[model samples]
Target: MAEIYRVAVHYGNDNGFVEYNLETKTIKVDLAHDEKRREAEEYLAKEHTIAVAQDGIRDFKDQKVNAAQDVESFKLALTRMWEAIDLHVDWSRPA
Candidate 1:
C-alpha cells in the first residue's frame, strides 16, 4: 500500500496523526502514542496566543470524530481545519 498523504498535528495536550493510502483509499489515525502525547502537551503549553490555542484545541478535540467520516468528507474537513489554524495547504486542485 502506498501512502499518498500524511500529516500530524499536536495540540491541546493531544495528538492527531492522519495518513491516507492512495492504493486503498483509506485513512488511519493514531492518537495514543506517548511520544506524540508529550509533544502535544508541549505545544499546548508553549502556545502564546489564546485564540489560536483555543481553535487548535477545538479542532484536535474533534479530530477522531471527523476522521471517522467518509474519506471525501474527511478530506474537506481536514483542509478547512488546517486553513482555519493558518496551516498552509497546497492542493492538487483548488481546495
Candidate 2:
C-alpha cells in the first residue's frame, strides 16, 4: 500500500500554520510566502529528494551491487542527481 501523509507548514516569522492535504500516491506541492517560504520549501524539497535518492542508491548497493557496467552507471546517475539537489540547497538562516 502507498503511504499517505498529512503535512502541516508552520513559519517561525509570525506566519501561521499552512496545512496541505496531499495524496502521497501522486506528487503535490502547496507552498506559500515569498523568499522566506520559498527558501525553506526549496531547501526542504531538495533535501528530501536527495535523501530519497540516496536511499535508493543504498538499496541498490545492499542488493549486491557489483562492478557491472550498469552498476557503475547507476551509481554515477545517483551521484549526479544528489549533487544537483545539493547545488540548489540553501543552508542559511531565513532573513
Q: Which lDDT tens digits does candidate 1 get at residues 1-95? A: 46456666543545456555666656554556665444433332231212222355455332222332345544555555444443333354221
TM-score of each: 0.36, 0.26
Residue 15 accuracy (lDDT) in model 2:
33
Q: Which stretches of candidate 2 lie over 4 Å from their true place?
A: 1-4, 13-31, 48-95
Q: What Cα-based lDDT does every candidate model obtain?
A: 0.45, 0.32
Overall local distance difference test of candidate 2: 0.32
Which candidate number would show the highest lDDT if scored against the true structure?
Answer: 1
**Model 2 CA lDDT for position 54:** 39
Candidate 2 least-lDDT 10 residues:
86-95
lDDT for each residue of candidate 2 in 9-84, tens digit (9 for 90 to 100): 3343333222222323222224355654554434333422222233554553323221112333223322332243
User: For each predicted model, how many residue pairs clash, with residues at least 3 apart or on different chains?
Assistant: 0, 0
